[model samples]
Target: MTTPQKIALVTGSHKGLGYAIARKLAQQAGIQVIVTSRKEQDGFTAQQRLATEGIQVDFHPLDVTNDSSVQQVTAWAQKTYGKVDILINNAGVNPTMQAEEASLLTMQLETMLSTLATNVAAVARITQAVLPLMQAQNYGRIVNVSTEMASLATIGSDYYPLAPSYRLSKIGLNGLTVLLAKELQGTNILVNAYSPGWMKTDMGGSDAPFTADEGAETAVYLATLPEHGAQGKFFAEMRKFGGPIALTW
Candidate 1:
């Protein structure tokens, strides 16, 4: 019997960067792409749009921040595909404002908690939920969509004035990536965090320098990496960075 094709789940892909990533993955033959969003309508719309382009895709509603929702999606994947070979933790939120005026206390208590819940905690939970399946197959690729703004090396330098909450969340995400990689050290599962650069998306904004297609490049590359490729590292535009470096947390 022929083996079934690989499966990929990309969250927040109803549009923008997530949409681009889903499209790219679908374009590859034999790859089943799951395009997900918080809303069923949005997910179906994205799936239909991709189908029009002759790309094989399915719609799944996933609200990364919600545990019940996460479980439902993972269960669906387990039942339908038996495993999720690639998981792109691309869902994130950035309610922006000037750093100085933003209440550090409030930011940490409210914004930071909420941001981490979705950007970091959700990623961790979902990865854990799917890890058993990967271990069974001895194959998995996890790409956490991170950002250059998360780089502590650039902080206090020329690139410091970006979205603080979003930055902190991704920084936490990078740390999680490292920890998971170390734990799964000898396994075939490869986990990495990537900064897609500033792109023109709802999150990246119109004035951003890169396009969604350009932004999705690193993510797609990392998703499709060979078993020998690097894991538990931070990457931006193909250049890997060292250590977790500090954030203002």
Candidate 2:
């Protein structure tokens, strides 16, 4: 029998790291890549871009913050692919204003709340919808795109001191990653937070070192991890960055 195709739903795949991850997965022989964005037009454009390179792809509009929109995408994945084998919770937002200082007091409540809603809450929402499907299959991989600044391991370091909203939200995201992995223990599904480092993107700015493709490498690797691969860790450059892979919250 032929190998089964793994169905993957990559959020915010219209551009940036998400786009690169989706493209890389689609290029693999037995992976059916589903690209999603908050905008339908952006989804189509991304789909067309991949198609021009001769990769077959599908698009679904997703607004991870909205329950209805999140459910809509999950329902489509269930209907179209039978099950979602991989989930990359990648769509995120940062403070729109330039960081004048690194202090939490300097950051506005609105900005932190906005960042938390998208960065932490939405990833949990989408994962909640997709987890059951993976549990039923007894196999899945969840790659939560996170940042190194979220590492409480280096909380006091001066150079990595700022972006309160983004950093704190990722800290919450990392917490979610740990909890989810614990809850899914003994199963094949592996949930982990991955830091792609700074890259050339809207949020990363042009001065960032890594290209979008280079940043997407680890997330793609985690998404395709084997049953025996590590789980429940903060990873960068394909290795565990801090502490143990599995631990309590």
Candidate 3:
């Protein structure tokens, strides 16, 4: 019997790390990639760009922070694919460059709240929306895009900035991953988080040392992990260690 195609949904894939992850996932056999963006035009543009590369993927308008939008996309995926095998929570924001981000005392409460809303809460929102589908199929691979800066163990020693908002949000994301994996224990649905490192993306900026494609390496590995693979673990970029290496949470 032929294996059925797995449907993978990648949030905020219009550009940057998400786009690179989406592209790489689409390249895999037996997988249908769905590229989503908050802006419809941007998603369509990304869809076209990938098409030019001879890669075809579905497109959807998804604002992870919007309840209706998340519901709509989940409904579409269920109606069209009957199942969502993978979910890559790649959508996030980093306000480290802002002046307020330099110090916790100066960080605006609004900025902190917004960052948490997107980087942390939105992941929860979309995952909650998609989990039932994965549960129904008894198979899923969830890769949460996180940062090394959020690693609590290395926070005091890292050379990165004190962008309190971004760091705290990702910390929450890490906690979410661990807790979700605990809840999903004894199941095929594996959820894990990984640091993409400093990549050359809109958030990483041009001066960053790594490319988004390089950053996307770990995502592909986690998304295609075999049954009973690593769960609730934090991983570093695969390129950095030549394979998936667990990071200190």
- Go through the candidates in order and give each one's C-alpha lDDT: 0.81, 0.85, 0.95
Candidate 3 lDDT tens digits, 7-35 = 99999999999999999999999899999
lDDT of 1 by residue, 33-144 (tens): 8999998998888888878877768888998878899899989998888888989989888766545315455455576678878888989888888888889899999989
Worst ten in a row by lDDT for model 1: 240-249
Leading candidate by TM-score = 3
Instruction: Flag regions of model 1 displaced more than 4 Å.
Output: 1-3, 98-108, 238-249
Clashing pairs in 3: none
TM agreement with the true structure for every prediction: 0.90, 0.92, 0.98
TM-score leaderboard ranking: 3, 2, 1
Candidate 2 per-residue C-alpha lDDT over 1-249 given as tens digits, one digit per residue, 9 for 90 to 100: 212789999999999999999999988778999999988999999999889999889999999999999999988788877899999999999773457335777788888888899999999999999999898889999999988778787766737658888888989999999999899888999998888877899888999777889888888888888887877887865434432233222
| Error of model 3, residue 143, in angstroms | 0.6
Output the better candidate (1/3) by TM-score: 3
In candidate 1 the C-alpha lDDT for residue 81 amounts to: 84
Best of the candidates, lDDT: 3
